[model samples]
Target: MELTDNDRSIATFTMLAHAVVHWFELAIPIFLVVWLDAFEVSVAVVGVVVALGYVPFGLGALPAGLLADRYGPKRLVVLCLAGTSVSFVTLAVATSIYAVAASLLCWGILASIYHPAGLALISTGVEDRGTVFAWHGIAGNVGIALGPFATATLLLVLEWRLVAVALAVPGLLATLYGLRLQFDPTAGLEGDSESDTNADGDTGSRAGSAFVSNSRTLFASSFLLVFAVVTFVGLYYRGVLTYLPELLGGLPAMEGIEPPAGLEELSLGDYVYVGLLVAGMAGQYAAGKLTSRVAVARGLVAVFVGLAILAVAFVPVSAMGLAAIVLYCVVLGFSLFAIEPFYQEAVAVYTPPESRGLSYGYTYLGMFGLGSLSIAFGGVLLDRATVGVFFGTLSILALIGAGLSVRLLTGPSPTDTEVPEPTAADD
Candidate 1:
């Protein structure tokens, strides 16, 4: 099906908004490090603050989902964009560590408003859900790619506080653009003739008949295994995303690279670390195309296996170690992001369309919320263990996660699709 002009416009706008949000996500880690050093605080404390941003995304997913379902996703997206803009700006001005903490807490909560609502909007707006979602993921990955670069650039030219100010501008512009969006309620919810349900998982019927069936379908065993694998995937992905820079600094390769000007001398590579993230963007886009040609499960399994091999390639003492680090970063980017579409497909397979929103909310909670807790734990582990132990531990978990993907292929359920699964999967 061809997209109408309005559909194209909405999708373009949605992608733009999503890219802006990812910028803030990429900025926080590097910023946290700078803040810690500037304030003479411990790395452990900075880790806590960095991890804190993730809390609201998970905790607020349900509410964000509910708001999308009830009031329409458009408003929620606007609110989140505005909230992020305000929060990022406040972060620029924040002097006290407590103030930065509070701002991030708010940022995390507001950032939560975007994903479910933005995604739901995209799903509703486009006829081709898989490709649209893939593109959406690409946009986010691109934002993530640019964010650290932007931060690094600012750090090069100005004080860290000024860098924060520079970062806030894109978010503010995105928020303003978001507020002007025109939403067509009828067009977006076209296929959703099912009864409305809130985010809390409460059941209600439309006129006591049309919407109130409460028998939630239990997935076949394969779905459970798929879910479990995804959980570990989430943990590994979030953990690595949280710690890559510190890992670099801890390594021998970066011991010689000069720090960004005015920044304290550090062992971490001084180049645009954003390049590492951009490589992942390339991986995600490639994976998105590849998943459709092969089975999603098979594609994910290949990526995960690659992750394990990349982990084994790690050696804390040689130049080969640096090559392994770059390789694994790209591999993680490929596998971590490439698996998302398959996960979305699994949700569609396991749950009824009417209940899909709630199912997705729970799935994200597992992936982002509970997964975030796992990330926090990894930070704790990093505090106690060496960088080698950290990657080694994550590699083991990823291999285990890949093994679980086999379960997804074991049952009849995975091969069956009630909705038209993507034909020409990458197209």
Candidate 2:
């Protein structure tokens, strides 16, 4: 399909905004390692403190979506980038753990706006939603990989504070890009009718009733099943990524490896972690390409089944040899991110144009908000059970998601369905 200049511009800005938001979000984990030495706090304490910021990151998405629907998405995109830049700068000057925690809290609130706003824009503003979403997912993975990579690399030359200040530059540039960017409101919608509806209505009673009505409509729709599937995916995502490095460290292949003599003490596992994330870029691209060819439900089932197998295989493969472990990382990373575009497409398929922002908002709330709890849950499992048990649990979650995807397949394909409009019938 031939993309117009407007399509290209919206896709570029949307992808950049996604990358900048994730870069800031993922950078915190790298800093958590730094804080261990800089502040002399226990790991458990740091985890809880960081959660203070993370919880808001998940919780704020719904409101951010609501706001994007009220205002234009462009405004929220600019705000997310600019605010994140400021938050990173604030993190740069922090002298205490409490200050760091507070800065992160600020960052969380700011960064939370992007997923809902960016996805909504792409889902509704880009004509080639599949290709754009695929590229968007790739950009996100780049940010996910770069955030920690940049932080870790910069720490070798400068203080962690300086590193944070350096990290803010991209957000500042993205903010500027967002200022000049414009999107066609009707680009991805089925028609102009819904887009022309008065998104902002009267206050007081009208607002209250609209909110209640919207809530009820959402519950009554297939969006609930989509949310459930996304939630299961989130739990798997969080549990696996949060502990991946530590788990890789326990691999036999990494047992005797050493960092290069001139560098700081990087481990084999760290390199493996980076490699896996890099591999996910291919997965994102492939998934995006497949969106036009494969059915969403079928693709989700295949990806999740692969995830389940990988989850079970990770332990045994790590014990085999370095070659085997590397292969495992590639496959695991690919499956981990490959499901994103399909599920994102599913949201647009299941929801109407008017509620698309809120749909993405609640989708991310499942992906990030409810998913955040998996960190603690994974921790508890690690402490109480065998590593085998942990992988088993992840497999179960992926299978559950796959089961839900099968259920979705039994209904009308998202691609085949006409975009619905909000009306009395919906209420």
Query: What lDDT does the true structure give each of the candidates?
Result: 0.65, 0.81
TM-score of each: 0.76, 0.91
Lowest summed lDDT across 10 adjacent residues in model 1 is found at 206-215
* Tens digits of lDDT, candidate 2, 176-215: 8888766574466665335542322101112344445665
* Best candidate (score: lDDT): 2
Taking the candidates one at a time, how many backbone clashes does each contain?
Answer: 0, 0
Q: Which stretches of candidate 2 lie over 4 Å from their true place?
A: 33-45, 191-193, 197-207, 412-427
Query: Which consecutive 10 residues in model 2 have the weakest lDDT in total?
Result: 197-206
RMSD of 1: 6.7
